[model samples]
Target: MDLSMMIEAVVVLSSGLRLTLTLTILALATGFVISVPLAFVRAFARPALSLSVLAYTYVFRGTPMLVQLFLVYYGLGQIEAVRTSIFWVVLRDPFWCALLTFSLNSAAHTTEILCRGLQSVPKGMTEAAATLGLKRFQIARLVTFPIALRISLPAYGNEVVSMIKGSSLASTVTLLEVTGMARQMVSTTFAPYEIFIVAGAIYLLLTSVVVKAIRFLERHLATDGSRRQRRGSRLAPALPDAGVTTP
Candidate 1:
């Protein structure tokens, strides 16, 4: 292993870090926004609505992300209507094409993760809320969604990590992300082993940071729940003596 070559790879690869992070963050943010409503539709809406969401998720999840990227970046341009359309300007850009593909793919997986979280909410809790006269939307907003979000956090974190790694695929569309830079350098220097190892290390570091953040969030949520429970216990009214007789 050439030590200097490895160091150079790190520096070169670092140039692409911003693009890599940009793609990952934007894709995840957009996906989360899109998935939240879709998840609700999938989990709580009528069969017609739910099945539509299910089909969307199924197609994206069933296909390889690389194929999706190719379809968006290459296949779309093949259509005369697409080329003549107002959206052509945005679709023609490789960066936007990659981002669109990644966001849709992430949204599909996130919808399923959130749907499972929503379904896992205890029936009794929602029922109790209803018995207290809470409206459906209010119960979902105040009780169900919050709990479901916490339940979904760990799984969502895994998705975040996956997106970080998957962002490397953007290189296929000529986006100069980390892996793209690594490939460029390898072609010039004929040192794939060193460059790729550095790229792998960068991905590992990003994932490690995500995992640590997820664990911290889980612990914080647990602490908050315990505190709320203790506060509730303290605020409860004291019962009158059980053995006391009425005058």
Candidate 2:
């Protein structure tokens, strides 16, 4: 690409990047905070007890987020009741609609990931906690959720990264996010290739930042203590053995 065109592309794409990153972080944070309790209920409660959470996760995960966004932004606008509702003031804009869709999308996947994490925890640990005089709620709060989070973090990291990419869908709803900006630049300059390449690069750069931050977080929250203790216990000789090395 020519230098002038490249510079123009970067300027436009950078502007879009700011909005993309902001929405991505806001959506993911909201999803993560909400998903834990949803997951807990899904994991431990009876089917009847957890019906709402289950249905919520099922509906969100099953549907395309683009469809959900459109339904919220465009579909809702068609409804007189929705227009009359207090929420209409906010939903009249596409930004909040995109935010709601992205947040709910991540929440569904996060709930599933955390549910798997909860299942991975051994039943013996819960029993032990109970024997130690821990109440049901106390055991769940103090032990289950933390352990489940640690176990599911890697998967959750992937979900978060996916969320960053998914935020591109926001443009479909008329939001001036990265993809929208790229399309606008293409239409204006008739240089689709240059504008798209630059916009794609901006998205790549933003996604890379997310991945690096998650890696830093994973390291900071590493469960070395439990793993090391488990390994040590395994390596320790259960009974005297001539072949065993002394440490």
Candidate 3:
């Protein structure tokens, strides 16, 4: 491997880092907002609502993300109605189309992960909140969402990482993200190995930061209160059973 070539590749790829990060961040943020409502509907809504949510998630999750990107960027333009509609202006731009596709794809997966978290919330916790005169929405807002979000953090973190890597597909739409720039360099230099290695390293670094952040948040928001419980247990006295007879 040529050291100079690798270093040069890194610098060139770094230029596209801004676009890559923008795609990843925007996709994940939009997906997160959309997922929450979809998750809520999937978990607690009527059968029709649940089925609709399920179908949406099913189709998006089942399909390849690359196909989704193509469909949004190229497929949408082929429709007569789309070409004439107000959305045509937005869809005509490859960047917006890529963003829209990525957001929807990420939202589908995030919704399912969140639904799993919601389902994992202990039933007793919600019941106790109800007993305290809280309405359904209040209980869900105060109890369910917080706990479920913590439960979902690890999975959501993975989703964020996935989106970061997946954003490389934006190059197919002329987005010129890191992978895009790498490909451009490779075309000129005919050196795929060094260029790709640099691109992969950048992705690894981004994912590592995401994993550490998620771990920190998980530790900070731990709901088990295990440390406090252990301390109290050690300090408290153990009393004899009231019903036990004297030996």
Candidate 4:
């Protein structure tokens, strides 16, 4: 590989980093907000309400994201009703379409992950909270949601990584994100190998940072007793003997 060409590839690809990060962050943030309520419904609501959530998750999760992107970006404009609707102003833009599609897709997966986490919370814990005179909403807010979020963190971390990778699909919709920039460079440089390597490395670096952050968060959120024990263990050797008198 030519050193100059490789350096050029890095700089060019870096230009698209903002767009990639924007898409990923917006999608994950929106999806998470939407999923929280849907997840609660799926976990505890009667089948009448839960069945709709189930159907939504199944449709989005079962289908290809790329196809969803195309449908939103290309297919939506084709319908006269869609074209004439007030929403068309936003739908006509590729960025909005990609964002909408990615957000919905992320919401689907997140709902299921959160639902599982909520379901996994021990029934005894909720019963204990109830017996203490906590209201249903209070128990859910003070006891249940926090535990479920902690339990879901690892799986949710994976979803974050997946969203970062999946944002590359935005390239298909005319968005010049990192992968799109690489493709554009390859067209001119005729060096797909080098250009794509840089792109993949960038993605790997992003995901690694996310993984480390998630691990740090996991440690930070550990139970107070566990955190204290771990801290004590680390500090034990540094302390002078408790019973030893100074010379």
Q: Using TM-score as the measure, which candidate wins?
A: 1
TM-score of each: 0.97, 0.86, 0.91, 0.90
User: Clash totals for all models, in order?
Assistant: 0, 0, 0, 0
Off by over 4 Å in 2: 226-247
What is the Å distance of residue 234 in model 3 from its true position? 11
Candidate 1 backbone collisions, by pair: none
Which has the higher TM-score value, candidate number 2 or candidate number 3?
Answer: 3
Which candidate model has the greater lDDT, 2 or 3? 3
Q: Ten residues in a row with the worst lDDT in model 1?
A: 238-247
**Candidate 4: Cα lDDT at 247:** 82
Q: What digit string (tens of lDDT, one per residue) describes model 3 on residues 82-150?
A: 999999999999889989999999999999999999999999999999999999889889999998998
**Residue 195 in model 2: lDDT:** 81
Q: What does the lDDT read for residue 117 in candidate 3?
A: 98
Give lDDT tens digits, candidate 2, residues 1-247: 6768978888877888788888988998999889988898889888885897889899999998888888888898899998999999888878888998898899999999999999999999999999999999999999888888888988988997788889989888888888998888888889988788887787788778878887887887776766888999999978878798998
TM match of model 4 to true structure: 0.90
**In model 4, what lDDT does residue 235 have?**
85
- Taking all chains together, the TM-score of candidate 1 against the true structure is 0.97
Q: Show the colliding residue pairs in model 4.
A: none
